[model samples]
Target: MFMFKNLKSDLPASIVVFFVALPLCLGIALASGAPLFSGLIAGIIGGIIVGGLSGSRVGVSGPAAGLAAIVLTAIGSLGGYENFLVAVVLGGIIQLVFGFLKAGIIGYYFPSSVIKGMLTGIGIIIILKQIPHFFGYDAEPEGADSFIEASGENTFSAIFNIFDNIAVGPTVVGLISLGILLLWSNVLVKKGKFFEVIQGPLVAVAVGIIFYVVTQTNDALAISPAHLVSVPVPDSFDSFLGQFSFPNFSAITNPAIWVTAFTIALVASLETLLCVEATDKLDPEKSVTPTNRELLAQGTGNIISGLIGGLPITQVIVRSSANIQSNAKTKMSAILHGFLLLISVILIPTLLNKIPLSVLAAILLIVGYKLAKPALFAKMYKLGWKQSIPFFVTVAGIVFTDLLVGIGLGLAVGIVVILLKSYQNSHFLHIEDNSNGKHKIKMSLAEEVTFFNKGAILKELDSLPRDTYLEFDVTKTRYLDYDIIEILEDFAFKAKERNIDIKLISKRGIVENPDSFIEFFKLRPKSKISLS
Candidate 1:
């Protein structure tokens, strides 16, 4: 079976992913204004149910950071947590419809640069957001709002608050776990197979739990359950199964539920597609996933998660990248991690409660660091202005704003830079030496040349020497911008008297522009080009 063969290769990764998921499950719950157990449920469902069905080998699904804002808002707007749960169920059904309709193709429409910006932006947000957690600030949960903390203050104020109310016990645990993680990661893994077999996160979590057990029994250094994860324990099998939440079929008539449902469906799908793309790149084998199949799997997963009273789920990049870094070679690693979540809640509820939140925070702090490493910035800088500008803009925007908005700003900047370069260069503008006693000057417009490049191109054409055998070649250009065509048409009048030959070619046909070129080459109202 796939599970048996990949067990060894995936064990270390599953442990690392487990540590990563544990905090996230808790943090997303706190942020969403939902019961903490709901997030854990979602994580279990994502891993066991969704992960098992995924077309992607390495992508790890769970309650997503991107959806926290929506979840928080929806719960308030719907007037109750239960109402929001209804929306979650509806959302999953909508996603299933979207998958069957082949809407997953929309993922391909997003530009690679924009997607890269999104990942880098999220990376910076993770690092900046985790700073308070690293310093032992537990008042505001990890993955709190970029604009405000639980105290309703901005990022800087939150940082100050963390420093002011630093918890010594949690801080100590954080530091110890961080130390073990760092040492195991940088030193131990490279030294021998034995150390590599047991990942740093596994070692860190094991140590944290052991520390908890020892200290709790001694009374002098006991950590309370509040500082650890507190999943409710079921007294019996029936009670345990009863813990699962079911969809309210009565909610079917509520228009508000449908609206919230569609929103979650759209956002969750986008995030999953993005995470899947990023995960594939992170994989050591560099395999590509079928986007449509991923959509279907994610949709099915969300339906199951919602039916079980869990939060909305998506393919999360942090966990997925952690999976890849852990050397996961098959989807079995992801599925097994899900099983671990399921089993842990049932069998090790007490032990889970002893592991400190600060320790998990320290683990995430490191995960955040790996994602937004200083070397990543340096490498982007070395790639020159073209790459560096977008990369840093993405980082800065994310640090200052939320994830989607930050990526949108970075994408806008990237598009402007691309247009500026295109305007400054010539696509078809060229000078040739004709041996037959004629100076052949050729000018070409780029495929899908827009008005952005019009001014520079027109200027270049106006400055061309007179009495030259000018050949206007639009053969290779598709969808010439009307402004450019108008300029060319104006040139044609004067060129006619000056003996310039204008030859226009397109998918439509070759034709000379008459009086005003705007009428001749204007874009059809419905005509569109694929920019992605």
Candidate 2:
């Protein structure tokens, strides 16, 4: 398989992605109000299972922060986490059904401007959300992505709180780690393959650990346990095995359970498809991921995860971006990262827990900067308002609200832009001739006209001057809406009252003063119009 072909690049990239996914898995679990271990379980399954099955070359899958609110509320409404597991299982089955239905084509509908906006927005959120952790403030939960945090402090407020809460130790370590990353990426990598293969994130984590160890005795400089990674340590093999949760199969009969399952399937599928689109765009090779296959892979992963008491999984942009930025060559990087997480938890939980969170924050900061650079903003703006409006709106919405809300806002704006453009292009109106004091005006219908063009067509028809010659051209038209045909028929009668002579022309036939527009054109049943 191609899995091992690029080990030099993929292995190092996997290490970097592992570091990123570890904390996020736990943080998203915390945000979801589930046992922290559940997130890790999802991460492991997502990487090993979904990564292997997925057609995406660069995407990374895991417990998603976007689903935290849904999981938290669902747990409560469903009466318990066990009941929620049943929904999770059912959701996976529904996703499998969706895959069979080939529902993944929905990803193509998203505008490029909105997709770019999503990447930039997530990047900004990473930078904004990590600032507090970089400064050593740990009040907010790790995986929380919303602007109004669970700690009752908004994103900006948390940054302002840094003025009072900033600690000496974590900040120092964070700065050093950030410097190492920058030096490695900017200078050292240019020298040799040794620097390239070693990876900066791994070195940064090592330094952070050393800093923690060396400062343990110095009260003023020691990194506190609260500001470090926290992986659950099991007492023994049996205890570790006990951590796995099973679904309450009897709850399958509950109507509420079905609703939750459908909701999860729909949301998770949409998120995965959107991430697939975004990930493909970010790929330097411009490789396209098979969207339908991705849904099947995700479905299989969630089913397995739920069987073992894990949270729902989706393709996460943060870890995927990190994987790409780290120069991963294939899906091997994603699969290996999952194995790393599993090994770390089982063999070296204590060592894993010792790594400082601030170091991880520093790494994420670089990832964020690359996505939302100043030059990108200028580039999008130069493309003009049409492209920039959705881009900026999406960025602002994600910063001010949340991921889905921001995308929704951008998508709404994108749709409006399409409608306005469509309205303008419905038809072309021009004066063909003006002789004998009567303007010979020709109104050519566009290639396709729907009810959306009704208003413009009606207005132009009613405004025609008396005693004018009107040439209604459909020679170039292919599909015409029944609504427009009705409007034409009505206008034909109105033209007579205004003393307007009419000439109707089309590829089908030509008629002078045609009695019926629909009869003359013989509009096809379903092919000619869309309902309206």
Candidate 3:
């Protein structure tokens, strides 16, 4: 029902996303140390099944790079890839339980500043990671998001290493691919319907494949097979069917399998929620996705993906952003892209392999540029320190560490900012000179006075001059902390020594000579007492 609404936009957008997601699915599987086809299985299920069930119009689901390390370790710990499949199946079941339990509300609590930082940080990571690939340095797998790579080099070091080992053929293909993508986005799409119908990345891949074929005899111009898309090709229909691995259901009794399952469910759900939030922010239409439904959809997808020998899946930001930038208008684009991956891998694996990795890298570079534009930094900076600090910290943390750790650091900073503001706004103080020559000092409590305000309130009370008329205003206060009340009671005795005449204005009206602070407060109901 959510599909087929915008064929004109969705069709071409699907084609672009398909190309973008194809390599990522394979690359993430390669990174996870799983059979490569498992990634494709997750991609197909993510797009066709999850996309259909998801409430997100623009979100595209697939095997995630974020879970690569988890999967790799789980496979080894579980004794085999098949045992890991058992965990994936259990993980999906756990995710479904989480959806029913309404745990998706956690998605709503992430600070927007941190989410934006995440987008910008991932964009920067994309650009950094792809640079090596752009120059034909293919040591790291495609779609790897972490700073530290499986190849022992970090993101920056990988880029530096590229200088020493650049492949001319892939470089040429990459530059041409980048040029075509830019032209299509900036110029060709505006020129006519013909250009608009043909997506730039599609054309880039076609040309890259042609270039690779034409340059096979020329050593300098020939792009090696290692630098090309490498889908697992089946020799026959039986072999293609054999590629689909079933989970070892007997391993379901293993306790370690349950542990791995729960971990996958938790991590995958969090990633999906975060991606859903990020994608919704990026949507031009400002659509709100149903976070709970998204979890349910993902749960269903992971179950199917695991049962069929696929890696775990989550809503991936990279493909979703690509779909949005390509003008995708509905879930149809995501579904269609999944179908494209399925058809291409099954029908034309050899032809698909001909497309150079550099071309795909170029396409991702464009996506990365759009996400982490220089203008975004200026805009965030203009929002002032409260917003900008967390934003910058999130970006820096993600660049230096990893996504979850970066978000945690940013969230901690954001919480501190909130506490600081609360501390500053706990109460208001005012002083006025009466005609009789006595200074009248009024201290009005904030709507909710907490223990954090006790020090500030005490300092203000201590600074009151002798022989002053002091009024404690609590008329508008809602909930008063016991600590603050105790402070006020302790100050009463001190006020007498300073010759200060204290008036307590509360819900019960003004009391001229109150008994002991504790007795006065205890005798009157909390509602009847207003300090004004």
The top-ranked prediction according to TM-score is 2
C-alpha TM-score for every candidate: 0.86, 0.96, 0.94
Query: Residue 248 lDDT in model 1?
Result: 72
Q: What pairs collide in candidate 2?
A: none
Q: Please give, for residues 4-30, the per-residue lDDT of candidate 3 as tens digits.
A: 658888999999999889889998888
Q: Cα lDDT for residue 256, model 3? A: 94
> Candidate 3: worst 10 consecutive residues by lDDT?
523-532
Give the Å error, residue 401, model 2: 1.7
Q: What is the C-alpha local distance difference test score of candidate 1? A: 0.75
Cα lDDT, all candidates: 0.75, 0.90, 0.89
* Candidate 2 stretches greater than 4 Å from native: 524-532
Number of clashing pairs per prediction, in order: 1, 0, 10
Error of 2 at 92 (Å): 0.8
Worst lDDT 10-window in candidate 1: 523-532
TM-score of 1: 0.86
Per-residue error (Å), model 1, residue 441:
4.8
Error of 3 at 127 (Å): 0.3
- Order of the predicted models by TM-score, top scorer first: 2, 3, 1
lDDT of 2 by residue, 1-532 (tens): 6679899999999999999999989988887889999999999999999999999999999998888888989999998999999999899999999999999999999999999999999999899989999989977775435563556777788888999999999999999999999999999999998999999999999999999999999999999999999999999999999988899998889999999999999989998998999999999989999899999999999999999999999999999999999999899999999999999999999999999999999999999998888899999999998899999999999888888899999999999888888888899999867867789999898988887888888889999999998888888787677888888889888888898988898776668888888778767544464212
lDDT of 2 at 364: 93
